[model samples]
Target: MSKTVVFIQGSPRENGNTRALAALVMETLAQSGVASAEIDATRLQCSHPGCIACGRCQEGPEFRCHVDDGLARAVATLPDYDAVVLSTPVFWLGPTAQAKMCVDRMASLVKCSDAGALATPLRGKILGLFATGATERDENLDILERQYRVMAEYLGMPFVSALFPFCGVPAGQAAADPEFATVARDFGVRLAGMLGGRKCCDP
Candidate 1:
């Protein structure tokens, strides 16, 4: 079976390092015969006020957000893919506000029960993070890594991550740096390996 991965872009800047790396990775993914899509967090942030915990989704006639906004609409389509990658440059060592809000609104896709939170539509799908930081210290990316790791485990999705978390480059430089480009392309190749596995494709 074929696979598709959706990358949620968290940078507001049109040509930042985050996008640069993502472009390389996406190119590799395309060459590897994997399909990909992207969602801009900057656009998605305006979609909803926030997840209100209205319980409407969990209590539902339909298991989804009742907000009737863009984020809600975008999240409803997540189950169609084989993988989800949260890609963003670090802001104070965490995701940008736009990205965080997009993630918050995704609560609509998960239903919490007495047993625990269940990411039914998203469960078993591959979850990944592509976090770039200007700092060379690999530790600078710990917060973003932990954030994605925790989310993946909680949602019961198999977790993977892109290389060069530090990236250690300025805005828009990832494309020019041959080393970073190699890392980024290899990340896509790695993701292809994960998504191509029979276990990942099983329903």
Candidate 2:
């Protein structure tokens, strides 16, 4: 069976540099013959406006979220995939608001899981990070790296790898960065290989 990969796009621009890089990675994975799905958080309806801090959904299925939004749907089905990839643009030295909300909504799952036990949705799954920034990849990339590392560690998932394409020049300039594209492609190929070569079958 094909290993399913879920890619989360966190940029608001549908065809922006971040999305372009994400597409290239997905294409490379396809060349390796892996099944993949791309979820654009910009198109999803998520309520991160403010934390209501409500206790509702704190006990139900681990995927349940207190807020009613697209995050709930995504969380419900995330466990079915073998690998998860998050692609986002750096906004104010961190992930764009769109992507942050989706990731934060996953808190419900992690909170409900018993310590020392695998988190409900991401247990045994591989997590990958991909990001783009306007300038100073050194700083922005570091922030994203730490964020994903903490996130993966908390979820008890393997932090596989990350691809950072520095596109701080302009809107469509990332395409001109041949080296970045090469790295992105390689990342995709490796991700596909890792998931495809897994011993456990898809659940």
Q: What is the C-alpha lDDT of each candidate?
A: 0.79, 0.74
Cα TM-score per model: 0.88, 0.85
Candidate No. with top TM-score? 1
The residue-level lDDT of candidate 1 at 195 comes to 78
* RMSD score of candidate 2 (Å): 4.1
| Model 1 ranges with Cα > 4 A deviation | 45-47, 117-119, 163-170, 197-203
Q: Lowest summed lDDT over 10 consecutive residues: which window, candidate 2?
A: 194-203
Clashing pairs in model 2?
134-168
For model 2, the stretches where C-alpha displacement exceeds 4 angstroms are 47-51, 112-118, 197-203
Clashes of 1: 0
Candidate 2 lDDT: 0.74
| Candidate 2 TM-score, true structure as reference | 0.85
Overlapping backbone residue pairs in candidate 2 total 1
| C-alpha lDDT (0 to 100) for residue 120 of candidate 1 | 74
